[model samples]
Target: MHTSTEFLLALWTLAVVEGLRVTEVVVPPFLVIGQRARLRCHFALEGEVLYSLKWWKDGSQFYQFIPRNDPKMVVFSVAGVTVNVENSNLHEVELVDVQTSSSGQYRCEVVAEAPTFNTHVLSANMTIIGKGRGALSTSAQFYLLETVNFGTQHHPYRAPWHALP
Candidate 1:
């Protein structure tokens, strides 16, 4: 008895009212080798209860948080991802002594509990740069350029050759 438009509108209303959304994903675009990095995932759960929060690096899951679990937190090992589990939780994760190999796409996935089990995901890229040995490596220079183009407000990317030493 309902028109197509009415049905579509009702679906939209339901989703908007009961949806879990990832509002922001904060991953530093660049970092110096051996420096620590903090990644944050912010979400809007609307009226849904949180089921789990997960962090993935280059398609490999490295961290998870489940509110109903015994410990509520779990960690997995992935190449180049050294999670500082002691400082990690639902809202943020910290990585200690990041290395050049840590550069990769990072994703945050959030799921809602119970019958619906709605899920949402968001991702960002990060790059790690080593100090100049003698001259900058080709990949390092490339990363510097890329960071200049797409840099975060908190850590504005800059290349100061003189400051290297």
Candidate 2:
């Protein structure tokens, strides 16, 4: 037994609470091994407070940036990879000295502040390209390059065994 006005109000409420949505995720199609690249994320909510932003590589949570946290940003180590959380800009993160292992789907998860706690996730794949096959081969190439050049010329794109240090 609901009045017409009450039912209309209920419909309006339903239309407004449209959870969370990730607008876009921007990542370079390919990254040069041993070079740095930034992955950008954009999100929006109907009308909710932003709780935090979290980044994941290959479905594993590696970094989280919470505005309310003491440190504001926290990171976890991944094999053959380095993660630097950019606090000033909440849109992107700098992955320094990338490696082959860095090739994977990067996800940006947006969580709403409390109450509803709705979450929206968006992901994009990143590819790492290098002349050498693997880390070992890349290291060998570097050693030879150093010996041949006598430490004269430096290649910025060339990565060592542990490229993502």
Best lDDT among the predictions, by candidate number: 1
lDDT of 2 at 75: 86
Candidate 1 regions exceeding 4 Å error are 1-10, 13-17, 135-165
- Candidate 1, residues 83-127, lDDT tens digits: the string is 888898899999999997899999999999988889999999999
Candidate 2, backbone clash total? 0
Worst 10-residue lDDT window, candidate 1: 140-149
Name the 10 consecutive residues with the lowest summed lDDT in model 2. Answer: 139-148
Candidate 2, 1-165: lDDT as tens digits: 999999999999885458777899998877667888788888886788888898899878877888888888888877755876543246778888898899889999999898888888989988786654444543333211222344777454433533343
Estimate the lDDT of model 1: 0.86
TM-score of each: 0.77, 0.67
